[model samples]
Target: NVTVIDAPGHRDFIKNMITGTSQADCAIFIIAAGTGEFEAGISKDGQTREHVLLAFTLGVKQFIVAINKMDTAKWSEARYKEIIKETSNFIKKVGYNPKEVPFVPISGFNGDNMLEETTNASWYKGWEKEVK
Candidate 1:
C-alpha cells in the first residue's frame, strides 16, 4: 500500500509540510525548470532549499528530483543540465548522493516523463525504465 502526501511548499504551510514529510519514506521533489523560476526556487529565500532541508532533517533520505516545467524551458537539454549542475552540490550538502539520486526532467502540465517516456525528451532516456 502506498500513501501520497502532497505537502504544500508555501512558507505559510511549513507545519503541514513537516507533518507530511515525517510520515514519508521518500520525497519526489518537484523543481521548476523555467528560465527565472528555477533560480528563484534555489535562491536564499526559496522554499526549495527549505523543503529539502526539512525533509532531510525529518529523516527522509530517498529523493527523486523531478525537474518540472521542461515544456516551458522548451525541453532544452542545456537547461536540464544547468539545473542539475546548479542543484547537485546543494543536494549533496543536504545528505543525498548526487549520483544515486535520479534527476528526471518532466512537464507536469504536458505530462512528460511522469509515468511514461516522453518523445519531447528523447535525450532523457533510461531514467523512466530505471526508476520503475
Candidate 2:
C-alpha cells in the first residue's frame, strides 16, 4: 500500500515542503507543461528545483517526475519528450540517475494516465509499481 502527502510549491511554502520531505519515503515532483510555467518553476528563483534538491538531501531516494497538464500541450509526444529530457538532466545533476527515475505524463484535469489509461497519451507506456 502507498500513501501520499502534499508539499506546497511556492517559495513561501518551502518550510512546509521541507517538513513533508522529512517524513516522506518517496518524492513526486510535478512539472507543468503549460507555456513558460516549467521554465519559470525551474529557474534560479523557483521552488521546484530547490524542492527536489532538498528532498534529495533529506534522503528521499525514490522519485516520480510527473509532467502534468499534457492536454494543454495537445498531448504531443514531442512535448512530453522535451520536458522529460530537460527535467532528467536536472535530476541527474542533483545526484539521481535519470534512467532510474520514473517519468509519468499525466493530465490532472482529465485524469488520464493515473489509475486508468487514456488515448491522450497513446505513446506513453503506462507505469505499474509493485507494492511492498
Candidate 3:
C-alpha cells in the first residue's frame, strides 16, 4: 500500500518534513517551473529555500523530482531544462549521484504524466520502467 500524507509547506513544517522523509520509503519532490522561487520558496543556495530539497540534500535519493505545473507554463522545454540543470547541480553539491535520482517534469494539477496520460515531456524517458 502507498501512503500519501500531505504535509504543511510553510517554514513551520520543516521539522515535519524531516520526520516524514525519515519514515518514508520514497518521496516525490514536486515543483513548479513557471512560478520561479515561489514553488520552492527559497533562493541563493536553493537548499535554504526548498525544505524538501534540504531533505534530499541531507540524503534522500529514493525520491523523484516532480516538476509540476507544466500546463500553466505552457510546457516550456527551456524552463524544464533550466530547472532540471539547477536541481541537478544542487543535488551534486550535496554529494548525491544525479543519475541515481530521477527528475520527471510533470503537471500535478492537470494530472499530466501523473496517473492519467502521457504529458508533453516526450523528450524524456521514464524511470519507473527503468527501475523495473
Candidate closest to the true structure, highest TM-score: 1
Query: In model 3, where do residues sit more than 4 Å from their true spots?
Result: 38-42, 45-53, 56-59, 128-132
Better of 1 and 2 by TM-score: 1
Q: lDDT of candidate 3 vs native?
A: 0.68
- lDDT (10s digit) by residue, model 2, range 1-132: 777779988778888988888989998888898879988877886667888889999999888988999999999899888888888788889998787778888899999887788787778986565454
| lDDT tens readout by residue for model 1, 30-105 | 9999888989989888888888899989999788889999999999999999999888888888887777778999
Q: Scored by CA lDDT, what does every candidate get?
A: 0.89, 0.85, 0.68
Q: How far is candidate 3 from the true structure (C-alpha RMSD, Å)?
A: 3.4
lDDT of 2 at 38: 84
Which runs in model 1 stand beyond 4 Å of their true positions?
A: 128-132
Best-fitting candidate, scored by lDDT? 1
Q: Rank the candidates by TM-score, best first.
A: 1, 2, 3
lDDT of each residue in 1-132, candidate 3, tens digit only: 988866455567877877776667677777667776533433664533465566655565576778778878788777877877777776677666666777777777777888855657777666642342
Candidate 3 similarity to native, TM-score: 0.76
Which ranges of candidate 2 are over 4 A from the true structure? 127-132
